[model samples]
Target: MKTRKKANFFPRFHKLFAVKKIFSLLFAGGAAGAVNGLFGGGGGMIALPALERAGYPVRAAHATALAVVLPASLVSAAVYFFGGVPLAVLLPVSLGVTAGGLLGAALLPRLREGLLSVLFSLLMFAAGIRMLLP
Candidate 1:
């Protein structure tokens, strides 16, 4: 009686998974960057989960998302500035954002992971609903 040998497929499957992961990473970054440029914020809404799925802890993901958003925000702001957006409209908003951002950053580490996720989801849901309205 002749026995058929089975091929080892795990290595090939692992490589395919790695490739898919890389593509997901790139897609996440591109989406985040585009959102940042177009909306002036909300990149973090895209990036946070991406970072978390890429193996960062909840808090670390939030912080990393902020880090990614910062440069994109700056570039977008720079373009608006050079394109004649008024400092009168920008400065006060920027100051408020800075203060609020500092407070949120200080608060992030104090929150539990589940609470953070719930709050994040709620905020996103609210924003989505708000955007749907006139």
Candidate 2:
């Protein structure tokens, strides 16, 4: 059996630090964490940009977002598990999404650069329109 090597910095945060910065990290982590748990997809999208604006390096921001997401994902999964959600329905969708996400990630590097921007903008516009609908 081939042992897979541990990948480094798939998500990492290496930055300068201070006492006050701990609070910032905690706050960023918590806010992003909750968004991830509550809404699912928008947390990373919002967190990365917001963290960049707040002076974190892009890589660090992503790492922070991932850090937050890890716990939230676990908790959400736990809640679903304990809440008597039918595993039959959840299992197929979870597997489908996991497989689809893997394929998307693999194909990501080969895709057009502006595609994400256009898609995100459209989603935001659609959401705004949805909000305005009577």
Candidate 3:
């Protein structure tokens, strides 16, 4: 049986950029990062495609994007806590998200590439329609 090789995370981070891909990466990352920073979700929804276009493997791009977002989440959580968001409400949601994230990490490599983009786009479309409906 052939064994799958593990990717070096930092090298993969560097690989996301090539001379020709600089603009694409900047635009994608800027757009995704801004929305994610503002809304607290949807960055990954944007990052995956940009990273893919820039030539990173979907799995690696997703992982790297998640890593990039981790600090953002932490800061957001801190702000919510300080702003008097209830711990009781926050705890369960946080736990569920963390558990689901762990599960997703374990299973991500097993999923077919490009599926996430389709799912994410559909989700955004649904969200948009829902907002419009009300």
Clash numbers, per candidate? 0, 0, 0
TM-score of 2: 0.65
CA lDDT of every candidate: 0.82, 0.70, 0.74
Candidate 1 lDDT, 50-89, residue by residue in tens: 8889887977987889898899888888887687877798
Query: Which candidate number has the best lDDT?
Result: 1
Stretches off by above 4 angstroms in model 2 are: 1-15, 50-64, 127-134
Enumerate residue pairs that collide in model 2. none
Per-model TM-score, in order, reads 0.67, 0.65, 0.63
Of 1 and 3, the candidate ahead on lDDT is 1
Clashes of 3: 0
Candidate 1 similarity to native, TM-score: 0.67
Sorted on lDDT, best first, the list reads 1, 3, 2
Better of 2 and 3 by TM-score: 2
Supply the global lDDT for candidate 3: 0.74
State which candidate, 1 or 3, has the greater TM-score: 1
- Clash list (residue pairs), candidate 1: none
lDDT of 2 at 48: 73
Looking at model 3, report the run of 10 residues with the lowest lDDT sum: 1-10
Best by TM-score: 1
